[model samples]
Target: MIFAMVNVLAPIFAITLIGFVLGRSKIELHAGTLSTTVLLVATPALIFSSLTSYGVTPTMLLEMAAAAILCLSASAVLSMLTIKMFGLSMRSFLPSLMLPNSGNMGLPLVMLAFGDEGLKLGVSYFFFVALVQHSVGFSIASGSYSMSHLLKQPLIYAVAAVILVSTTGIAVPEVVLTTTEILGGMMVPAMLILLGSSLAGLTISDLRPALVVAVSRLVIGVLSALAVIWVLGLEGRVAGVVFLLSTMPTAIITYVFAQRYRPEPGQIASAVVASTLLTFGCLPFLLWFAVKVLEQS
Candidate 1:
């Protein structure tokens, strides 16, 4: 288990460390371009490629979506309870708790730990998480519900097209399929580098609140995933994927939102950093458990 954990996590950590070094060094890499490529080009391509190529049933895919929604819903309730219990501000803290870094960190972890099949499942989880983040998360942070924002995401359309083609048995052009597969292949490493880069640039001022949120998010997230799994009767790679993704750290983008809307961006920044740092300790155990679940299945 120890060897497996290290083998799985080492590459992710090394790439992220490279990004971190580049972030703090004199090199002038554009964060915007890298992020844009991951979000717009690589990720969408990956999604289309994975969905089209994956052999999982559509029923399984929908269940993954259902599982993701349940996980986020559980997280939201847990976040609200944590905030009320601690007397924390909602606008700043809630979004942080609710949104996990399922894109940059989650995708790579799934790919490394479980391969492309797991990547397909993780992408479903990510899709719903991003959807909820744009809809519910943005509304909480910005104080307005914007439907247009959700519609504008390219992944939305890509997901729809994939489903249509996949379910209908309509053959996609071989060239288009090959093209997406090639482009999508870049997503995992690029996002891992971006994760490290984001962490390198983060600024944390207070450790107290950050520690509180980080621990709560991790604990509550794990419990919630388990509860949802039991209730949904999920198992196999789907179960492992949900469990592993549930253990993911908070999204760094939460701090970006806090900086825009809230008074204490530093606290949010600290939470992001703390949770991500803590993930190094937590992920090994989570990965081991996920693999065990897969084995049992």
Candidate 2:
């Protein structure tokens, strides 16, 4: 079990470490461009191709999406309670508490742990996650919602294309599929590198608040995920993806949003790095428990 878990995680962390090394060095990477490319092209392509190729049905997509919403909502509520108790800024902490690093970390873990089927579910879950981040999460940070911005998001088009292709039962051309597959293939490595690079530059000036938030986020994530899994009665690869993704660390986007729309970006930056580092300690056990226990849920 340990060996298999190591095999699954080693490459993911190693790639992240490479990105971290690059981040620490004198090299300059235009992260904004890379991030834009991933959001505009690679990720949507990945989502469309993976869902279509895997023959994931609308029913499955809906179930995964619903699970994601529930998990996100649970995290939000738990985070709110914690935030109130601790007197943390709702504008600053809620977004981090609610949005997990489902892209860079969660997707790769599920794909490696459970293979193609896992990727199918992970991508679907991540699609909705991105949607929420743009909509509800952005609202939390900015204190206002913009319908126009949400409509203009590339992911919305991706989801629409997925629905069109899925519901119409029309076969996509092999050339198009191949192109998308090639483009989509870079999402994981790009995201991991971006994650590592982001982490490399962030320093935790104060550890206590960051630790408090990180541990609370992880705990809320696990409990919320387990509750959702038990309530939904998910099993096998579906259950595994849901559990793994729900337990992910605070997303780096949290820091980005904080920087843009709120004060104390440093607090969020600290929490983001601390939470991600802390999740590594939990990954092995999460892998084991999902494989052994939750697979039968």
Best by lDDT: 2
Q: Count clashing residue pairs per candidate.
A: 0, 0
lDDT of 2 by residue, 212-259 (tens): 789998999899898998899887778889999999999999898889
Model 1 alpha-carbon miss at residue 163, Å:
1.1
lDDT of 2 at 174: 99
Model 1: CA > 4 A from native? 294-297
Candidate RMSDs in Å, in order, are: 1.3, 0.9
Candidate 1 local lDDT, residue 33: 94
- Return the top candidate by TM-score: 2
Against the reference, the lDDT scores of all candidates come to 0.85, 0.91
Model 2 ranges with Cα > 4 A deviation: none
lDDT of 1 at 76: 91
Error of model 1, residue 254, in angstroms: 1.0
Residue-level lDDT of model 1, residues 187-215, one tens digit each, is 88888888888888887788878988889
